[model samples]
Target: MSINCRTRAQRRNQVPLRIVALRFDFETSPQKIEQQLITFLRELRWKARGFDPADLEAAREADDWSDELLACSPSRHDSDKIRRRAQALADRRLRASGMAHLDKDAREKLRGLSDGVRVVQLPSAHRADEIAATLHDEMPWMAQATTLAWHAMRESVRSGAPALHLPPMLLDGPPGIGKSYWARRLAQLIGTPSEMIDAANEPAGFAVAGSQRGWATAQPGRPVELFLRERVGNPIMVIDEIDKVGDVLSNKGVNFALSNALLPLLEPLSAKAWSCPYFRVTFDMRWISWILTSNNRR
Candidate 1:
């Protein structure tokens, strides 16, 4: 092959992960590849090893998707243990929905998360320094907030966390100074998915803690759904206009301010076992980085 051709082929080899079917090669015969997969699966453990292509019609009639999980999980997470955990959760969701079999929409909705929650590789000191310098240049006015994020990022790395986890940060300053923007940029550098919630729109705080299943508008919290969509365990969440989160009361006379909703999630122990009101499932949300922004320290 020419130099360019060789380089391209090498890159392609690395592009695909070491997952189920990806282990096969063009050079290997089908019989040999099948044997290789069997041996590999024998060692790996879990359901994929037992998936028989010969039973395709039977599996199709039954409407199962376990075999296909092998095809997509390599990009989701690297740990087989985590993959199993995610698989269990996905199975529960499917069973609870009372679906007779799996379909495209179900697969798409739970795609990344059904695979696993990926713990992103922490940033190195050099990378951290680069991000700090960039943030400083872009939003010089939020230096203190920037410093806290920088320190937290470094501490998480030192503490040997699987992913970059920053402590919940409350940034207080005048509006229009790019505090939320800075938080988002930091998430980008750290390679975590992020979401921005305008507290002004969420008086009841259900957007953060999720609502009871009995409620007509019930659904999983942003953090849970974000994890499912992005497959990242440590996603950045920016709560903009936190001071505007009203002290709304329900008919029963209970306050549901966003700040109250955040207490359980902010507490390390409580967050580790947070139960979603909508899904009725416990989730470990401690690793999520929360950045709450406000116009003033009210």
Candidate 2:
């Protein structure tokens, strides 16, 4: 990697690293586990009441169900109500089962994000304009991009947004023009955390879109790691030399492409409920600021 980007102030606010250990049930309290078991049993009994397979079979043969089983549900039949309830329970179980790929350590790492990341908001519109002035001086070559950033900041300020969120930007320019550096600088000025990804080095979309659990190298993507590391919801992500990324990277008979993987994250609606392939967890990644720098249009 020829480029190294750094932002002003560089408020990394990086959390201390934690070494994950082996998985063990003893890690949790017996009382808590017992309580969970009790709750599950109670719910299971409630759902099973008057809805046993044997009872249903007998009712089918006799063509006469008990009053409780034949009662009409508000929106449907009693059987329909139980079916919906059972289906809902099954859905929750399936979702939890999908997380089987994650280890205890990985699960713990993601648990911290329950409260969500912090939001960095602009102090005022005037401050945004001032920052824009300073940006023009720092990298005059990126003036047009700077102006776009300025407008985004002004809009954020005017609307009293919780964070200074910017739209996805493509910096089309020749190399050695400080496009990557300027992106980091913008993150600093906006007080949002940032991560830089070299697309030339990425063999798959794991850097941003996340690697699946069954993959040889399975792990969460930068966006998820950013939220965990910086504790910020909206972070500036710079994908340097995106045009240099390969059309596709294949392994274990599975193909992955950075461009194709980014489609969901780039779209606002999909981004709001973006799911990480690593942990099988959904997250709202709408506020992520993307700056894709390219040397050519490829």
Candidate 3:
């Protein structure tokens, strides 16, 4: 084969992550080539060992498009190039980590449970089923609560239709029933991490003091606001004990100060782009999925 063809073939071999050339003959059987490739990938512990032929073809085509884009435009962040690079890196890392040996059935099980989250609007039945499946290996009542919250969010997402109107979730349930655990586990099943905040402990102070009267006054940090700074766009943020939120425990003299502090997050009108009163900076919470849990239904 020509040097260019040989180089291309070597690159293809390297796509499965082991950085070495194979000892196959020019007349090697196709089946044997496949078997050897699979064995090599398995020995290296590649996570994408079972990638479908179609997916591989798509990836290859994407790489071709990315190359063309690079040749024509030469922008580093070009969408095609970025996506292709991301896929290549993901393939390399998965294989290098040897996640490929895990049971395909287990991966498939997680996929089925998480598939709905990928859709714009998940069906209520599917959402409920997903919640149930996530808690399948856990306690019953807790599972039921998770199912309820999941369905509520699903319904909220559905009602908004072409535009999303669900301002995340605020789950109110009794303590010791796995409220926070449900949020964390649900995030995990969806392949996203959950951020948890105890509403009872966040600092209450101005992000910055202003020149006007009451502007220099102390304010409180709202849990949701802080969570937005940390996990802005994820599918879950667990704000626990919302009832005890704010500085009401202090007799420093104030009424509804905590509610006022949280007003930007709780009020339908002010919450559109909630901000920290201290910093006077607004944050976007529309697309974020929040799961607020309180002992009291309020």
> Which 10 residues in a row give candidate 1 its minimum summed lDDT?
16-25
Lowest summed lDDT across 10 adjacent residues in model 2 is found at 18-27
Model 1 lDDT per residue over 125-217, tens place: 666677677888888888897788778777776776666778889988888888888888877766667888888887567888888756687
Name the regions of candidate 3 deviating beyond 4 angstroms: 1-128, 156-174, 203-231, 246-257, 296-298
Off by over 4 Å in 2: 1-29, 33-102, 251-254
Best by lDDT: 2
Deviation in angstroms for 234 in model 2? 0.1
**Considering lDDT, which of the candidate structures 1 and 2 is the better prediction for this target?**
2
Q: Supply candidate 2's per-residue lDDT for 186.
A: 83
> CA lDDT of each candidate?
0.64, 0.69, 0.44
The per-prediction tally of clashing pairs is 0, 0, 7
Q: What's the TM-score of each model vs. the native? A: 0.64, 0.68, 0.41
Cα lDDT tens digits, model 2, 1-298, are 1122224232344332221122222224334444444445434443566465435435534645445443312224533554555555544543444444556687678667544556666777888898899999988889999999999989988996666678899999889999999988887777777888888888468888887777787778887887777667777889988888776745575668788777788888999878778777677888788999999684
How does residue 200 of candidate 3 score in lDDT?
A: 66
Candidate 2 Cα lDDT to native: 0.69
Show pairs that collide, candidate 3: 45-98, 46-95, 204-220, 205-219, 206-278, 207-278, 208-278
